[model samples]
Target: MQEKIIDDKILEHMTLENVFKIINDNIFPLLNEKEKDFCRELQEFCIELHPKIDKNQDVYVLFPELGKRGYMQRINLWRDFMPYGMKSEILLATHLSCLDSQLELARLASGILCGNPTFQHGETDEILKVQDELMEGSKIGCIGITEPNRGSDAVNMTSTCRKSDDGSHVIYNAEKVFTTNGPKADYFATYAVYNQANPRGTMVQAMVSRDFKGQLITNRLKIPYVDRVHIAHTIMNEVEIPVNYILGDNGKGYTNLFDGLVPERLGIMGSGLGICWATLAYAIIYTNLRQQFGQNIINFQGVGFSLGDLLARTSSATALAFQAATSYDDNILFAEHPSKEAEKWIAGVSSQGKYLVSKLSADLTYTVQQQMGGISVTDNTDVQELSSTSYIEEVIGGARNIQLLIIQNALRRYSKLILS
Candidate 1:
């Protein structure tokens, strides 16, 4: 059967024309008629002014935005206006990645996974202040789970948080590496082992304020592309915040930390989706323009088949990512104790979805570059951004190996459920 003619609208070469179509047709229409105008306005602003792709910026300039307050408020305005749905998630993520968006937002997305304004225990006010600052784009945020010894191995992490003698404060002492948005982050939803509490030395999640002294934050990991999104090393020398800074409760820190996995990965997946779209689009245009053997290179079976495979992968990833996002959006996930059923579903998608999408995106970007051959390798083309950034994401939130382990654990749980 022939595919619908409308599906071909996105195939227009090297343009945002198709992106506008998808947002209008597949995504925005899902909203009420009242929102159509908002979608229209957003499409206009994004097409002309999305900063990531259109702007050439240095890390120094970008980092300041994190310190500037009220920036996230503007971003959050749209986020709040949009109804929560898989379509909304997909559209926002896909669009953000297209423009090399404010990378700090991704970090905030991860921190939010811990708990947001409506969810945090007792410290809702502080979280709200930080969150408000983050949404306003003045204050940056980071998820401080990874340590120097065990990256993403949250279970075996070594940092510790101890209550002060007066029981009024939580003191943190540790060093963390690969802290995304760290140098600029005003607050870190950090995970550390809880000392002098039940289940002694149990890992707990807390909010570490940058305003507090006795902390070191530096841009130690200097890579090529993502410096604009600073990944720094953080050294906490008796960094202290009130016990209220603790997210959720002390012993349940890990569980609170777990809440973010699905959303965080979904956000990352969206960025990957946008990159895949751009990479594939660019390759399509490039191959058609460049000729070989008296015809455009796109006519060759080798090139054509590769492109077809990439399309298949991108489509499959879109389906999987949306399904994952929907699974998460179904539940508010604010309860101090989440149900096992929710945990199972969230675990399944966040781990497996992130692994599959990031890997596929990396592969697709690589294939697109190969079609262009030589120039793809040089920094001259945007393909370099897709190529390098995808690699960073593969290891970003969690490594491929860690994701595989989570997937394995989730499968094990599923098998027991089936047998029972």
Candidate 2:
């Protein structure tokens, strides 16, 4: 094949379009005729859902069924439209978009209300089946991992899990704080310190369904800009799950947790990339339109330079995210141990992407808002919402500081590898 060299400006435009096409093309082809029709329905529903994203106000109206029926319908539609593997890819993309939506809402709602809570019920096989069903309908599911005292240090969890005398059931007791979708989740993936007869280890994963005898107490709190979702402080008082309800091998819950983390990080990176793209698009339009002196504001060296920098960073971040996704997919296909190098690169790139894109997003939004002057502050203006939500891109998934930690860890590992 001949070497092709594309100009920087053309490459930038192509990259932007390509990222969106990746999502649209992957998602659209998977649908059959009926599923395509269902997708239209979902698109309509999503349009309605978008406005309600300002706060938790619309979740009840939008997610009334709150069962497998709704989620499964959507998941089925998605799967039917996309290839099997592509379904998962597109699902991740949809979730990234949803997280961006949620993060936008959080920005508007923060300080006006607290974050949304996870629903109180635990995860069960039945619930998982239901969730699988509902996932076809809905792309998002919330699980509570953080407790009051054990935020980052999940291994030091104080929650206790004890087996019944005959080992027929297990009782769990713990308090959970800051459970996202806490008051609204269909089911919860809960963790506790399980004490078995042999006491092989600490920690276990349990599925808790909403119907379980647990409480979803929405603690009243104020967030800024938007109304809060039903975030709660939860008490799991003697909740019993059948012994078989364990998500993985007994005493091996930590392994499962670790396994899940890579995907979770990838999901976060995807969201960050979306935010970066949105911010870039916003800046491009604003800079081209806003007039300062006799020419468009983009004519100024400072403004043009900033836009150029942001554009480059956004493109790079997106490429990193795509590469990570591809690497993850390949690793799974080959049943190979995840490439330590790839993982490290992903961790580093994702962390940098999160940081750069987050900062760039905020800067671009604020600058664009400044270009609009006072109108940017008005609640009714689209830019106003965009500006308010920009800060949240940094905080979601992992905070900027956390990303820095990940980058440092990756660097240390890379250096050790070089020396060894």
Candidate 3:
């Protein structure tokens, strides 16, 4: 006996192409003409590339492909890519996540996590060269901030660095866990403190290159779900970095670290947005076609109402993400003298938005899975993969509690604003 095949039209409608159609219907109305065009190009590119990916292999192999299309990142001006800004970066993340969440994770680590610092703070020729390499995807990058014991307390780093006698070099002896893309990274945006007791005044950020002489060790972490994207535990012993490689020197590293967080959280929100949209779109299509009791499951009140509720929440979260991205672009990215007040407001709202959307991604995917039933767990669809990745959404960028803590501190500051 042979397995029965599903109808060709049903198979075609379930593809990423159809997913793009659903995504455009929901999201294009909110975008400007240029933004819509960018999304369309990304959609077409994703459609063409999706069939070529070997899911079992490392996603790093595809970096150059993204680089060729100027898709590695969009937060800052890379070359001649138009409409470059925070919103564009968010859109890039959204489409990339929809294409492959695992690849999006690695791309974020290499492009935004490492490349962003260079664009924001770099001045020297060497650092600019590093930027070009990263943007061009000739090299891979990762950030080292999290450690074995120091996770949430990022400011209080256990990793230590020292200045050489000539002051031309910074030496690091550090251990970093959860170093996404570390196993294959050519450039590392690593942070350390010269004085742990005075980290705020003595922290340093360096762009550590693999070609540099040092005992740099990276072992792939056992993150089974996102195996397509490497994560590692990296140990650096006396990694000597030239002063020119430093993106943030002395106390400036503290400020740079926090500055990077806003965009990082926003990027995560965009990825979460894609997860929400992709999973919901898949469920909508699946339920409408799957029949029970001689009728489509989507027509049943239970399935229909639940999906409707998820869609409403997903749309609301997307609006919040776009609103935040737009504000950041207008005030920070494009402003001659960026508004301090808007910066403060956006910093707080980033936490709020990240918190809401990350959790929503998980909830929406899980609920969609339940509404979708057993087929969702199979390889025939993307729902399970989305759900698996969504499970980690609340924990990355900053964990759920961390986002809440930031929001809580902001809430406490409201009294001061009220009195002033």
Candidate 4:
């Protein structure tokens, strides 16, 4: 066989159409007709958009396209997009992640991380304008909660803030790290504290625009895996934000910060779940076609069984993510009167699901790479890219240890309920 023919034979299975077909075949049964239609629409969009992407360019370049389609964020009703809720958001994240994990990461940061605060806490015209800009992708956004000294200890932040005498402006002096999309963001949904000793009592959450007439500086951090996605080391020196831009001030910032994390983690779960499915789908396609010892490699007991194990685990994680999203939608996002009990339950479950799925994304990608061999490691296939994304999954949206800590804290609480 000619080399061209051979290359075509192996590469054909890795096409977006085939991969989407596989994922759709597996998961569509779980979705209703409308949800399935949404998936198909995403599939078509991804299929069309995938080929045009410049791998070296910034992911933000695609933000306008996402905004046009209401793909920037799906959790809230932005424009006329239907089925706007947590589950829809999850599906959107999943499809985007499968299409391009880096783009999805940047979108989540801009759309959900930054834009979400506006929806959740913003009550002023100024903040709403920023929200519209972010959702429309006319302006990019990022969150600045994680600081140099505070990774998992997010609430007790050292970044300081001061309110003006007239109370019309809040000044922030903060150095934040691990800020995804920060370098290119036009607005920052950032946090700071008035008193370090009383962070919870004095924290402030504000939407700081890049042109806010303050020294809001950002330098891109070298996260080599998702080079298209910009993570930043942000330094805010006397950045003065108008009081109206403050989403949460005083002790309310602490509450708002924690409130945002549940959905943020759930969104990450959606992204990780996509990585799992994409890795599995691509590996499955490649293994079933690549020949070894005069037989397709997938027929071998070792490869087949390993794929089986990954399949089962990915399906279970998908179920967990979908269920959590559904419950969140029912009890929180779309709730007329949100159920406190369900809220409490979903919070714990989000931590648990985030922990499981994030680790699973890393593990399964590596395992599937091993199963698919050299082609997977090369750009000839997407396994290597998926693996790159997986490596960061455990670290983002709070590290694996933080998720475990949340789960453990929830476990400790069970003692009181059961004992009572």
Candidate 5:
């Protein structure tokens, strides 16, 4: 096999279509025709829905009868892809590109991967009948894990879960912060520390309803650039749910919860890749068409270098992300009790992929925006909106500090991989 390196001028000269085809050929060959077509529709739909991402209230315009639901339900991508297992990670990134933020992907994954009753096994679950209502887009869902004071340290949580007198149900109480879809989610994959006898406890995750007595979103806040999507903090005050509602109720709920994290991180990787690809595309077009000094700006070494740098970072991020995804698909997807070494290695790859992509997104977008000059800041410029939103991507999955923490943890837990 002859290897063709995509250098600065090579990428600069190539058409966007050719670039994407290369991406398909190498990184995402697993994407089938049906999934490709769905991505096209989603991209076209989002463009049509809010052609100009900024200064548009269209994102807030809900489907007439769907309550708070947006176009995700109208398209039915979740229902079509949720049950597929490993492939859902790839499709999720495709989905996030059209959608504004990683929050939506994480929220949907929380429901589809974690909240879905069938995630535990092959048996039929009555909960499936209840969540079937979600297929239509009438309901929104969220996953609650991180508290305001503690994010990385989730195991030593203060939240508590206690069994009722007859053991028919458990009471869940926690102040879950940075919860995506928190304000509007009708169902939540919530977690609390169990073992009332001890002040400190291990994790216990559950699926809780919105109508529970003490359930409330409490406050609403907007994340910059993607302000149209709601982000909120929530509190569960002694919320009670039937024991059956518990997800991964076994003593090892934390282990089960981890099965869903891969998809969320992969989804963020997809979003970052999309942002850089778009930024690189815009930079290429602008430099080619926008004349300076009687020649195109792309001819200049400095401008070309910036574009090349963005291209290099974006491509690297894609490679890392795809490697992690494919590794999971092939090695970890069906493996039960994967060795600690295998788990640690996968975690390292995932963290590195996510961190590099997120940091690259923020850097790439900002550099391209600067290259475009002041005009790039105008509200109508797609580059400006994308650049601004790319900044938000830095903290979407995890804050940069937390990303560093993940990297450090990976090194400590899997020194063999790092030292190799």
Candidate 6:
């Protein structure tokens, strides 16, 4: 049998063209439509503009729109163009092309935060970038560390990577749960504990492409709305990939995970800020337009006071999210971890900001829904959608409890500084 060879340009074009089309036609149109609808609804409801909320909502609806708009043709261009950009000069200089440039990666992360299915939708690009070899029409890459059994504890992974004597390949066996983009990913950045030497030694990061035999199992996760976010699971049954497919050094996968998580946390915080802004905007409009006792509700001291409190919270949350983003952007330049002291402070602040905004969004959304009275419960009502989304924001990308734990951990590290 003749070995099949993959053409780089063909792969690149297939990836980039599809993504570009998806974004320009599907994502952008839906964004514009939603923006117009949301703005008009707010105006009719007499609400103020909330950029963060607007951006987040735009992201949530972008996935289906990409499918609808047939823009998958040019989706991979950003991934290809990004690594060579000025921001990623250092990474590009190293001749690394497996992962995207930092800016491109950031853009992709941002798209995901906004609920765009760039990861799933741009699978072709993912494969071209991450995998060394590719087969035609292959799906893109995915990250599948999280599981139904082990949530945050990556060390407790049940997956195992066993090396063969030939040293040509490694066999991977594990069941991964809660995989985002699992169903569609052609390749996977999979984390598994290698048990060849000793079962309790260290974890290894391997690149497992879909060409290797594996099963994508869909477990329907119930959310409040049909248009809610999507997540999935993947079962790897003795999947095989080249021995060279390992990422970083063996046993250092956790470090990579930690480094990656900092940015992920910041990204989630940004989305939360957006949700908070949206909630406050909704509350402001509802309080003004709603009438009780023959006068607008805003005229009532109680209603005005509640809205004022939410506005104050929104402002504080915005400031915190901004500060955290700034810190993260700056830290990207530092080769080492920002001073442990600084890291602790920033982590604490970011966690607090995320939690505060999440809570405020939830409270404000509820208050606004109540102010809207009977209409708030209906699916057609804008307030209902806004309220439901607020809850989604609270749970997605690490919940309030998780943020609190992060804050507590950071605070523990800073205890001596405070005492001094």
Per-residue lDDT of 85-137 in model 4, one digit per residue for the tens? 89999999999988989889999999999999999999999999999999999
Could you give candidate 1's per-residue lDDT for residues 133-220 as a string of tens digits? 5554555667777778877656677777777899888788877888777776677777777753443336667777878756646555
Model 4 regions lying over 4 Å from their true place: 1-6
- The C-alpha lDDT values of all candidates are 0.63, 0.50, 0.89, 0.90, 0.60, 0.47
lDDT of 6 by residue, 1-420 (tens): 022232333223323223223223322332335333432332222212111123223233333322222211221223332211111221111111111111112222223221122322223443335422211112333566676687755557788777767877777787777554455454567777776344235666666767765453545344434133344567877777676556533566556555445544555454444444444454454455556699877888777777677666756655565456546545532426556666656656656765776677678778766655664565322445555555655654566787888777866977799889
Residues 242-360, candidate 2, lDDT per residue (tens digit)? 76456643566666555455445555455444555554454555456656598877888877877677666656655555555656556542335756766556556656765765666
Name the lDDT value of residue 89 in candidate 1: 51
Model 2 TM-score (2 dp): 0.70
On lDDT, the stronger of 2 and 3 is 3
Candidate 5 structure quality by residue, lDDT tens digits, 1-420? 023332345334434343344444434454567656655554554444443333444233332222222333221233544324434444444444434443344344344443443344213354564455454455666677778877776655667877789998888878877776677677777777676344233567777788765655546666666665566688888888787667656455576566555555666676777777766675776677666799888899889888887777776777677667656655666557556665667776666777888788788888887787665566434566667667766765567787788788656866787778
> What shift in Å separates residue 364 of candidate 6 from its native position after superposition?
2.9
Considering TM-score, where higher is better, how would the candidates rank from best to worst? Answer: 4, 3, 1, 5, 2, 6
What TM-score would every model get versus the actual structure?
Answer: 0.82, 0.70, 0.97, 0.97, 0.78, 0.64
Clashes of each: 14, 46, 0, 0, 0, 23
Runs in model 2 with CA error above 4 Å? 1-56, 59-100, 103-128, 137-140, 195-200, 214-221, 225-229, 292-294, 333-360, 414-419
Score candidate 4 by TM-score against the native.
0.97
Which scores greater on TM-score, model 1 or model 3?
Answer: 3
Higher-TM-score candidate of 3 and 5: 3
